[model samples]
Target: MGPAAAAAAAARPQKASAAGGVPARWVCALCASCFVFGVFVINRIWSVPEPVKLNEKALFVERTQTRLSEVYIPCQRKQNSIHIGEILNHVSQTHDVIMTLDKTISNLEMRLAAARAARATKQEKSLISADSDIELSKVRPKVFFVMGIITAFSSRKRRDSIRETWMPHGENLRRLEKEKGIVVRFVIGHSGTRGSLLDHTVDAEDEQYSDFLRLDHVEGYHELSSKTLIYFSTAVAIWDADFYIKVDDDVHVNIGVLGSTLARHRSKPRIYTGCMKSGPVLAKQGVKYHEPEYWKFGEEGNKYFRHATGQLYAISKELATYLSVNRRLLGFMVHRSQCGAHR
Candidate 1:
């Protein structure tokens, strides 16, 4: 081979990468080049003068100080322009350094004036206040309630001791009212609350039951409106509540704790109250919201689907409005029971 050809062949990358099959020599060359370039960049950065930004007012002060040795004050004339003959005579009498300094000072003044005109908007006080109140009082309240009989739908022939769950809810509301001084509103949509005193719909009273009332308002749970579509219809009801919470008629919530937490976070813009969600549920137990597009639904480890079931959920006033206004925009799901994804 010719000398140049032999040199090029020797410099060429020969060995393949162990994993991705890229040339190993090329990788080494690239890494070495990056390292050298990084060092050069860092050295150049270190050598650069740390820039100091000066306010116009500050620079004006320094310029005023430099004018101290000169005897005559710069006279302000009322006429349209300064007399050039007078300025030239003054410069002729002054030292070259003073003349040079005066010229530099004049140039700085002219340039600063033009710059001030160009950048007047940026220099003016901002109309938007950083001091705006993010307090709850800034927004009108929106309250949503998950009023209904929410219990485990068990087809087991005998009932579980689950009926005992009602005692705490009534007592809980009384405690919230008497001790905390917040009125608790409960709406019951199902026929037999069985244990709830605040049952909004009664089976014997209404005959068919007002099951559709609460279900019509929520998304995934809209199935009373059609369980097969199974969007948790509960979130729709949240739009109505300034600060809405949807707990199962079964779960024991410490409203004192909940109220305090809510009060502390009253100023927060968006809040979704719950324990962090995790894992998967193929079982019809616990909480379930079917998401066909799970990957786009959340990050790999983040288990929140498009919605959660009625076990428990809470929304702040702002989020209630967001949910209400955007309900039409949210494309919900449809299910085919013959080929059930859950089963």
Candidate 2:
């Protein structure tokens, strides 16, 4: 071949070798730059601030132990103060004692309830037996008069006055009972003063006249409502009449007029016949018909509700029976006419 062509071929081999060397140098420079960048990032991460860690569980346990030693341990060491264990023991014992007392009270209450039930049953049975002798089936009474009077052992004068003035006796009473179907009875409670003497006098009076109904309860001014309840109960137990009349011994009633008025309203069982007083309740103490428990009437209104005057009133048989049967619930409220008797 010619010298120029041989030289051109040698130049092509040198250019190929140089191109291969350029790629190897570029790879080495890139590897070196990557290593420098990695070192810089690692140094920056190491230089950054790091948060300190604490053992929180151990700290909490230490604080709790310190509080216990300071408060509870000191309390226990004090001579005058009680310990937690002692207090706990005392509370447990007190609870046991209270529980025992509660059980005892419950037992007593149950026994009392049973006694009351037994007494009620006995009273009902006795009344039924007495009813056979009275021949209640044959002679059903139409009107029953229950007179309220406060009679003591020394108050024979009052009873005598009642008997002589208005109350009919012996054949007159029997004739009235047979013809008009009316019965009059005096209701009284046992006296506190001279009880035995009073009881003997009452017994003697009952033996002679047989018109007195002596209650088992002791007499007192505060027990006026209770006496009224007993009077109703006794009257209902004795007879199932059409109308029941309650009158004070001091008030004289015209039997003819009362019977006529009752005949007109006999069909109406939900009526109460009496002198109803409607006026403002007196707030001052010691006034006649003064309301001692004015607060029960409320703060705004000063007037009293229309209620039957305590002197005399008549109730239907149904109302009388209801009052007698539910005496325990109604006894306190039945006599709240002008003022509270309990007060």
Candidate 3:
């Protein structure tokens, strides 16, 4: 090679290959350009009105998913020199990212809707001003048993099973209310999915059953404490019962036994009764009930603080009120089933 050619070759930046001999700089530049384009598209979409924005976003996601899947499916199945595996992986990751962003946007939209509903309810409450409110003695609901089942958006079958078997509804529900003076309600957060299919399904179920308490939060495994807090707060807002109870959906709650159990503590303030026990803090990463935030409790020797299991638990109106009022001050542990029990 000539000296001039050698000099020219040295001056030009050497192309670095990523996996499967694809240029790393090219991949980086493509990713960066896609990110910028995504941001710009999102900004433009968000500028529309709420109704239009939702429709537009849904359409955009559908089109994008279809296009990306069509483009990547061939690459995913066949081997190629252009790093098809890496491209497939990138596409999969991008889809996940989009889904996550969609969920977040949906949550924000639900919050706004919930705020509006709350405002309307508040207005109605102000108009009544307790003038038309029935006394507890006359109404006969001394205890509000809020079976705050930590359920998901897609768990319609489970909720239906609970409704058909243990928890009564329709005329049977009214009979229970009249006889036992105990009310049962299933609490759930709004859907985290992009479309409101789950939300609408739950709403339709509530219309038929009249037993669901929908909250202004997103449904997820780690959001149990927040959902519980909202459960108590909503209970207090709507009822003047002497006691409030929270139970899970999976637990078969014998309403008769529960009423008897709560009747004993009806007069007691700050009463928190349940099958309480202490368990060892699982510090290991892969164990069942592994504490991801284990350091919050203490060093390695610390056991979890004694708490009422999430299966079935009851609290007095006073304690529920305290929790409802002081939600901001309360610290929430991630493993909600093992904690959040307060006296």
Candidate 4:
């Protein structure tokens, strides 16, 4: 073989080897570039804030705890909204219930008021019907004995019992007044609250019976002496009677016997007749027939002077006139004298 041919063969082999090495180097370079790009992307993904990172497979960025918390907050807000709506619904239901209860109470109150008004109307009608047949005398007549029966507004049942038992009614009462010249009347006074139901009831009763003596004094248990004095004064003013008798509503008396008993003493000028009694003066409070001025009776545990029992008593015209004339002075004296007396 020649030397030139050998050199050509060697050049051909070198050229072929050089051409294969160039292709392999280009492939390596492309692979390295791809790796660098991937690395940069991974670094960018990992370079996020501390709470963000790549998943195990590096397929995508994992949602961090902070992002998950942010998502949960919206869900929590939705839940809270639902809870608030439920509370508002409950409040609305409670309000409806309360309104219903209030309406029911108002209805009950109105019904009660209507019932009370109806009852009052019925009572008024009954009273008017009861008084339809009564006829009363217009002129004041001369009388011999004036009997004042002390009573109170609340003593209607007691007065009824008395009228049913001993007191005359209808024509019999008129006959007694006309023939016997004995005036018997129930004495009462105005109530503390003027023009009240009590006063109206009393006025209605007086219109029906024509047997009530209305006084200007106020009715009270403590002012019994004043009441008695007023009764004497009023009886003396109205009638020319020989005797003025004061009797309690609870007392039972035979009118025939009382008339006879008074007739015997009619001639006396100044006679006071009653059952005499002596009772101890009570110093302590809250006791029955308690005397506030017990010290005026000399001492504690002392007894009152001899005096007539308050249940029934009679005073002649002269004494009654004196009592009427000196009412203020005698009233004070009588109050002092009867301070410790049994009621």
lDDT of each: 0.42, 0.65, 0.69, 0.72
Off by over 4 Å in 4: 1-141, 282-302, 331-343
The RMSD of every model to the true structure, in order and in angstroms, is 33.8, 19.7, 35.8, 25.8
Better of 3 and 4 by lDDT: 4
Candidate 2 lDDT (Cα, 0 to 1): 0.65
lDDT of 2 by residue, 237-293 (tens): 555566777776666667788788888886554467788885675667676755656
lDDT of 1 by residue, 112-230 (tens): 53233223312323221223212222331333232233432331111122223332334564463355444333332332433343232232322332122222122234433232111
Best-first order by lDDT: 4, 3, 2, 1
Model 3 misplaced regions, further than 4 Å: 1-144, 193-195, 282-299, 341-343
Residue 135, candidate 4: C-alpha displacement in angstroms? 23
Better of 1 and 4 by lDDT: 4
- On TM-score, the stronger of 3 and 4 is 3
Write model 3 residue lDDT over 191-296, tens digit each, in one string: 6673477778888888998987667678887777777887776666566566778777777777777777777865444678889877766788887778777787
TM-score pick, better of 2 and 3: 3
**Candidate achieving the largest lDDT:** 4
Q: How accurate is candidate 1 locally (lDDT)?
A: 0.42
lDDT of candidate 4 over 248-305, digit per residue (tens): 9998879999999999976545678898877787778888667776777787889877
